[model samples]
Each structure stands twice: as C-alpha cells, then as structure tokens.
Target: MSVDDGAVAIIGWDPSLVRETVARGLRPVLVRDVPAHLRGTSIPLPEETEEIVVEDITDVGDVWAGLTRHFGERLHQELRGIVTFDEFAVSTVAALTSLMNLPGSRLERAVLMRDKHLQKQAVLAAGVPAAASRLVVPGSERIRTPFPGPCVVKPVAGGGTAHTEMVRTEAEYEALLNKLALSATSPFVVEDLVDVAQEWIVDGVMQDGVVVFSSVGRYAAPCLSYTTDAEPLHIYRVDGTGEDERCAEARAFAGKALQALGYTDGVFHLELLLDRSSDTFFFGEVAARVGGCLIQEAVLLKHDFSLAGGAVDVALGRPVQSTSETTDRCVATTSLHLPRGTVVRLPNSGRFAAADDIHEVRVAVLLGVNDHPEVRATTNWQGLALVSAASLAELDARMAAVRGEFIEQSLVAPTFGTGVQQRAFLADYEDAWRRLL
Candidate 1:
C-alpha cells in the first residue's frame, strides 16, 4: 500500500485536491475533459501532476483508450488508484477501478449512489428508514399514486435540484410534466414529501466497510427552499454534545444508510430529513463523493483534517488516520444568491472577509451593467462564505449580520426577464426572506 512511486488517476481537475494528492507522496494523473476543464476557472494545475489523460472522463471507452495509451500494459502497476471529486464521474471511476483491478467502491454500489430510485430501494430493503418512492418511465402507462398528498418529483439521476419540483395536486403534477418536457426515455422518481422540521447533512469517510469519520451539520433551511422559494442556503456543523439527540441519531443513521447501499470504502455525503413531530430521521439521499458547496472547507475548519486527502489515502489502500473528534466549536457555510436580474453592481468582498467570524469568502460570478444573467435553479451561487462562531447563539447573530448588512446591502440588480413583473417578484422575494428568518 506504500505510494512512493504510485500514481492515482484523478478524474477531474481540482488544484487543491491535486496538491493534497501530491503532498501525500503519490503522483497525480489527471483524467479530464478538455472542454469542461476549459470552462472552469483559470487556476493552473499543480506542477506536481505526473501526467494529464485528456478525454471525456464520463465516457468509459474514451477514458479506457486514453489511460491504456498512456500507461500501456502497466495500467495496474503504475496506477495505484482511481478517484474523482465529481459526482457525474462516480460510476465511471468505479468502472475504471474494477477494470484496473484497483481498490475502490464497486460499480453496483456507485450506481446506487448515482440513481435516486435504486438507492432508495436498496436502503429500504436493508431496513433503513427512507421516503417511499416510485419510479416513472416517461412512456409507461401511468401507475396509481404510490403516496397521497404532496410529493417531490425529480429525475432519477440528477443533481443540484435541477428539474426538481414539488407537486401538491394532480393539476400541479400535470403542469410539472409539461414544464419539464420529458421524453419517452426519461425516467423520474416520485416520493412522499416528509414533513421535515430540519434537514441534516452527514459527511464521512469509510475504510474497508466501516465508517472511520463522520460530522453532522444542520441546514438553516431545506435545500428545496433555496431553489423553489428563493431562500438562502446555509449549514452549520452541529456541536457534538449529549444535549442534542438529533446529532447522535444522524451519525448512527448515516452509517446504517451507507452500509445498506453496500458502500464499503471511500467517502460519503448523505442527507437526512428530520421529522421533529414524530422524532424520526428519514434518509434523504447519499452521494459517493464529498458534499457540494463549502462542506469540505467547513469540515476542515471543524475537524482539522482534509476530506480530499482522506479520499486519496483510502483510494490508494493506504491506512487513513481517523480525525473524528467531538467538539463544541461551530462552523457554518452559506451560499449567496441574487434574484433573477441584470447585474448593476457586484458585492463588496472586502467587507465580508474583514469580519472576525467570517473565515472565507468566495465570489464566483463577475458581472457588469446591462448583462442579463440566467436565473439560478440549482445550488449554483454568485458567492459563498464560511463562518465560524463560539456558540449557536453567536453563530445565529453573525449569520443574521451577514445576511442583512453584507449580502443584502451589497448586490444591486433589477428584474431582467419578461416572465414575472418586478413588483410581484419583489413580493415573492420578501415572503421567502421572511420565511427563512
């Protein structure tokens, strides 16, 4: 398992992750799509990268050809591991891992992590508590409603909440179908919308079928609220204390859910819906990669460890030093959003970065006057902030200050499209903001 001269084929280009891999004494072979790599920020790849396998990382044939051409018959020996931070490449990585006879999660388990319907079925069969879901093929005869009342409809294999919708009535469901314009081959899932009081995210690392590390964080508002209702998305790590029963419950549930899905090794990002009235936790979904947004950053601040580094170690079959520890320290992350509009002004990043409680601020979008920007439906953000506090009360206060003083005051934009009137849109925004508060 020593990685002195071993090379790990990373399926995406992330400079920080590449640096971590290099720091671990393993050479990094970047398998990236040229077009996608160009679309990202202009950060240079780490100089320590051993080789670049340029191809469509999501295509098995292309990746196989590229890797074989580069490594020739030494694919199994030279390449010690294959890994990816990209969600879309999870299944591809798994297939490549097996093809190369490398240590990694099985392809079947990776597929379960990718497809929501299959994931739910597997977990539920293993006695995990999860929302009941039914898969709907576009051309199939309509089946009877599996669950009554409000439900969530989403693509079987989707991310970032794109094309996800909440349907409360038959009319809404029909309208949603027309809106999505799904073809005969498209498949979707319909699941009961649990009355969720709080949504929790559990990020962890696994080694040889056992969870070696885990951390729980509660969202300020449900993820659906951000896209559907225009509420800001925020999450804070739960201070692992005995006072909060949900924190302990979430950690236990995440282990069970990962085991149910047959995810033996690698990292996992799992979501759980808390039904406060019933005191129950339901499996939301699980991904075979790190959670999106600033989750990795937040985890590092809270636990003093690197998930990216850990993923590399596990992939290379090197023993990972567990950094799991309980603490009262608080860390939080929030995504900054702006209403659909033409940007008139950009935010003041300096002010945010100066705040004592704010650890990091990232502005992703650059804008100028009169340029129309597409409305955000996914978790994409104009900016992201990571903040830390001494206590929950302090965290709340600091977050409120960020929302009201920094974020709300910084952006200036006017409604751009002809779809909704500016006045009505303002009213909706206000309502959503109030609900978030």
Candidate 2:
C-alpha cells in the first residue's frame, strides 16, 4: 500500500505535528476527547486533517465505538495505523491498533510498559539489570521491602513523578501511605532506591524490532529531585559518533531493554540510572511515547531530523532513515519551576530569546500580579528553554545564566499562612535564587 492510500489516527491534538505528518504524504485522522478538545486549547485544527472523531480518549471501548461508527466498513481500508503522543492514551492506542489489525505496538507490550511491576518483571526475566520491586495493593496487609535501606514508592501506572516519594523509616512509610490513601492513588510499587550518581535518558526510534536512530542525554539532576529541590532540570545531549564509549553503552542498553519489553515499532523514551562508583547502569523505566518537555525539539536541533515525523513514518510502515549522522554540537533543554505562591512579577522572555544560543522560549503559565500559581507534587514547569552551544561547558554556562536571569526577574510572594508547608515553600523559593548565583 502507498502512504497516500490510507490515513493515520493521531490520538491527540497537536497542530504542528499534524502539519509535519501531512508534509510526509500521509493523511491524518485526529481522535480527541470531546470536552478536552473543545475546552483545552484555542488553536483550530489544521486543514490537512481528513476527519476527527471525539470520544473519551481514556476509555478504549468508547474510542473503538466512535472510530467504527465514523468509518464503518472503511475502517480497514482507510485506517493505516493508530498512534498517540499522550502518555494516558498509550494503552488505548495499542488496543485500537490490535482491534483494527494495524501496525503499532502490541497490546501486551503496551501493558508491560504501563504497569511498573510488569515492566520490571519482563526486563529482569530477560537478564536485564534493574532495581528489585514489588506491588502494593490498597487495603492489603502491609508488606515489607525485600531490600533494606531507603525505598521509592509511586503509582504502579503513572508518569512525571507525581506522588512519588522516598521513605527510610516505618514512620515515614506510614505517613506516605496515609497521604496516598487520601489522594486515592493506590496499587503502588515499592522499589529499593539505587545509589545513583547521575541519570541518563535515551530517545530513539525502532522499526520491526530493530533500533534505527538513537541519542543519549545526561541529566544535570534526577527528575525526581525537582519535586522537592530548587534546581532547574537540564538534559545536555552527548555529542559524537558511536565510538564515544558512554553514548554507545547507553544506546546499547536502551536497545536491549526495549527488545526485552517487546517494543517493535515507533518512538521510545528510556531512562537509566548510573552508579559511577562501580560503573554500572540500572534500568529506571521506559515509556512508549516521545520524552516529555523539550526532548523532541532537542533531537531536531542536534540530529537534523524530526522524531514526531519519524513516529508518523513508523506507524504507517514506511522505511525510516537512520539518524546516525549528527551535527556534533552541544544542545540542552531546561525546565524552570516556580515556588507555590502569588505572582508579583513575570520574567522577560524576549531577553532570553534574544541570545544567540537560545533557540526557543516557551512559557506554559501566564500569571499576572496577585495570581496564585498551581500547586502540585510533580515536575510541572512554569517555563522551558532550548539552548545550543559549541561545548558541554559552554552549554552549562548558558543554561545557568538563563536560569539565574529568570529567577531574578520573576518575583513570587508567599500567600499561604505560617505553617510547615509555607515555611518549606519559602525555603525552596529562597534557595532557588541563591544557588543560581
């Protein structure tokens, strides 16, 4: 079948991605939630979109019914593949692809990636090194950790470190459980925390169970640290050919882990924890979609290719060109977060954008004077920036400068009453500015 003969169903609303897919010769069929698509964004759909079907993207049965009702008999002939950029819709897209007999990640593989326990079991069974973990069901008898020392507890099926915590003693564990119980996010996974010196993220594209393109990035700080710490999260790309030992090792490990998980096609985001003392790497987790934040933009800037476009190609069963040839330039993506308080001033984005190294400046939240920022236990950022430099040291300096400037110009006043929570917030707010200098 030719690329122009059938359409690919994209399960989220991204106008720019739709335009990119259209430019590659495949028609796009959008699938979105009725309430979210109508209320979420003000941007209109692209003219290249063939058709859009609205349903609860979280409900696989509703989405299946909606797709069937819209296409009827043409579902088989018109639909080439099903894909999604949203983490919540990964399993839904996988199920639909299986039902439609289209090309995409299998349902079982998707399930393994979605559930933390299952993912660890699959990888360990295949002789991959990973942290030992066990499942925790709500209302069940309290289970002790298999390994001693500090352990991490988090939702069995979630991302972005929301509600993830590290507990050392029984009192802390009990407190965490009570906190989680009130929130109703249960079925947690408790794993022994690795003595990690640094964390690395591997973003790549796979075709027919083989890796085609891969890149390695070193995180300045672990993503989990951002939830309580004041440091900005930065990921600087490792530049060089496959001969670079660290980059090669990370890429190889990522490929082996993805293969063990039964991921055959599409883009993948994998994380690995490094123990510098022993020169060992531990499997953190993997996702079936593009890495969140500015990962896609970083890949495009360094590799001169589009991961979004690659996902569209893989979904449509088109041959993917290898991204082995890179610009050999240093690029990094930084996410800046604000303390929980009322906004007194906003940062000057134009000043950051004027720098030669700065490629893009994105402000997610627009807070005016006296507006309280949204509070959450996650790595949600208020703004993001993309920068490129000639060397790693230069990249770090530029990132530090940008981060320092943003915090200095933006002022947030504490609105919460005097309490432990308010005191902690104020401490983080002050420390964030102090560390920048």
Candidate 3:
C-alpha cells in the first residue's frame, strides 16, 4: 500500500511539534501516553488528530501495539511518516515506521543511532572530529587505551546526563564502574573529556540527504562541569551568529555525522567543543532529536525557527525555511536550579521579569522549593529564563543585572547526588530479587 503525504503519525507527544505539524498542512496522529499522575493536566490535543494513549509510550511493546491498534487498517496507506520527540523512543518509532513501510529512518540504522558507542564508531570511521572513546565491559580484556587527564564515563544506552561522570583519576574511573554496578548486560563508554573554553551546539535540520538549515548556540559554562559550590544554576547558554566561523565548522561536522549515522530526515542536535586549548573543534555528542532547554526556545525567539517543526517538515519531505546566515540579534537562556527539599516560597521576580528582552520565564518546580537543593543531573534545575538583545555586550550587561538581582536571589547550596548511594540501594534490591527469582 502506498502512503499518502497528507497525514503524519507522531509516535510521541510534544505540543510544539503537534501545533507545527498541523500548521504544515498535514493531519497529525498523536501517539501519547496517558500517565495516571499527569492526568490532572489535560494536554490540549489538536482538533484534528488520531491520538493513541498507552500505559507507557517509552516501552517498545506498548508503542508498537498502540500504533497498530489505533491506526487500524488505514495505517500503511494513509500514514505518510512516523515521527517522535522522545530521545529514548527514537529507535522504536523508526522501527515501527519501517514495519508499516512509512517514510523514516531505517530500523537497523535507528537502533545504532541510539547506541552511543556504535554512533561514535560510525562517526570515527567517517573521519569525523569526535572525542576519542572506548567501550568498557566488566571482566573484558579489550580495555586497552591510555587514559587522558580528565575523561567522561557514560553508560552505553544512557538517555541523558544520567550516569555520566567526569573522572579526574583512575581511582575515580574504577569507583564509577563499581558505583553503577550495571546489570551484567550493560556496558559503559569512556571518552576523553573535551577541553572547552565554551560549549556550542549545532541544531540542524536534515532532509533529502542534506542539512538544509542549522543554528549555533554558545554556553556560558560547560554543561557537564558539575560543581557543589554556590554557583548560579542558570548560566547564560545563548544562541550565536549562524554565519560565524565556528558555526560553519560545526555545520560541516554535522553533515559528516548525519551521513555517517544514516540520518536522512529529522532534527539533529550536535554538541561539539571549540577546544579552548587547541583552538579547534571536536565533537561532544549528537542526538537525532531536538536538544533540551534553550536551543528550541532561542531559535523561536530569534529567527522564528522551530527545531521540532523543522523536524516534522523534514519527515513530511517539506521544504525547510532555515534561518539566515547572519543573525543581528542575540538570545540567552538561564536555567535556575532550585534548592532541594520541601516546598518553600520563591524569590521575588517582579523586577527582572519586567525587562523587555526577558520574554519567557518558566518555573518547573514551583510547588516544592528547596533552600539547599540536591543536584542529580541536568533535570535538577528549578526554573529557566529567556533573554534576547541587539548585541552581545548589551546582552551580557542585561544578563549580569538580572543575575545580580533576580537569578541569584535564592541563596542555597546545591547538593550533588549523582545516584551513587541510590545505585548501591538498587544493587541490594536486585540481589534480593535475583535470589527470589
């Protein structure tokens, strides 16, 4: 059965993507999970949608059955493309799309895309500039690589910054492994820690075997430089000029990565380093979906670009309206990491929030505020702010003012809890379960 180009099936739910998918002149079928806890907040489904609710969309079995049962007989014929916003579910969505013979990433390639170890292997095979890495499995003798001064430890299939650590010594490396106590099957990936003066992200749109458009973002501080000090949680990781030399280099790197990863259509968020020491660009990491936090919002506020929308357009084989080469405006996003513990009153934001460039203020953990917050991963942040300006200097000045006044009002020391204790607890539970089973 030949599929029509009028309807697109989204295997996951993202409000922005749903809205943009509809705007692109296509019918949307939202395959979403109706979680018991989140039922209180009714997500406004598009007026035109074929929504598929499941117990858990992240599970492959549930997603497969949901798409099959909900789409019914017309799935293969009417569904034009299969799309998803969930990072972990990307492979599952692609595989299901392939089974239905829809237009999307190939099942085999999609599976490899999610595996960080293999992704780097393919990228390196293509002569791409990426962090040198090795896969470590317990009791495996193939661990033959000289360790760098500071390296990053990553679980092979880690979804986000979870289980990721910056190991400064060999003891720390071994300790990280013992700390994880991963299931026998799970292995880990270790990469040379990137020496970065500033971290930048290339959020690009890929379609028709080419990168149509890309945006560059600069971080005020490295995302993974975890510290327990009373540092401001929300540093300005802002978007930069699209035509800058670094951005150009990043775009070239991204093209190579896409080809290597077999990504034909979708939004690709590529994180690479502008090596502070070497004055060179090196690949940090890559994902086949939109980047979390500021990347998406910055694009919209500055260039009216939607990474999620661009992705849908790519899936639908629609033309992309990528941003211009040079950007006259500057945009910055500050993530406020709230203190941990019970609920408390929030600081006064009446002054800084009133600024004109301060367009968006989002509070994720307002119900429960903490004075001494526990930092686990990137998800530990409490709130975020979006600011834009006409120039970099003005942007910095405004950001400094806001930081001094509103962003730093809550003086709480953050606690670093990278699941070390939690891992030990889980290891005990698993031991008990293993014996019982």
Give the per-residue lDDT digits (tens) of candidate 1, residues 213-240.
8888888887777666566778888855
Give the count of colliding residue pairs in each prediction: 0, 0, 2
Please report how far candidate 1 places residue 119 from its true position, in Å.
1.4
Q: Each candidate's root-mean-square deviation in Å?
A: 6.3, 5.8, 9.5
lDDT of 2 by residue, 35-104 (tens): 7655565456556676555667768887777778877898888887778888888898888888877778
Compute the lDDT of residue 430 as modeled in candidate 1.
82
Candidate 3 or 1, higher TM-score? 1
List the candidate 3 regions with Cα displacement exceeding 4 Å. Answer: 1-7, 34-45, 138-149, 182-185, 226-243, 323-327, 345-355, 369-375, 400-437
Candidate 3 accuracy as lDDT: 0.69
User: What are the runs in model 2 whose C-alpha is more than 4 Å off?
Assistant: 1-5, 40-45, 50-55, 142-148, 241-243, 344-352, 368-378, 407-414, 417-437
TM-score of each prediction:
0.86, 0.86, 0.80
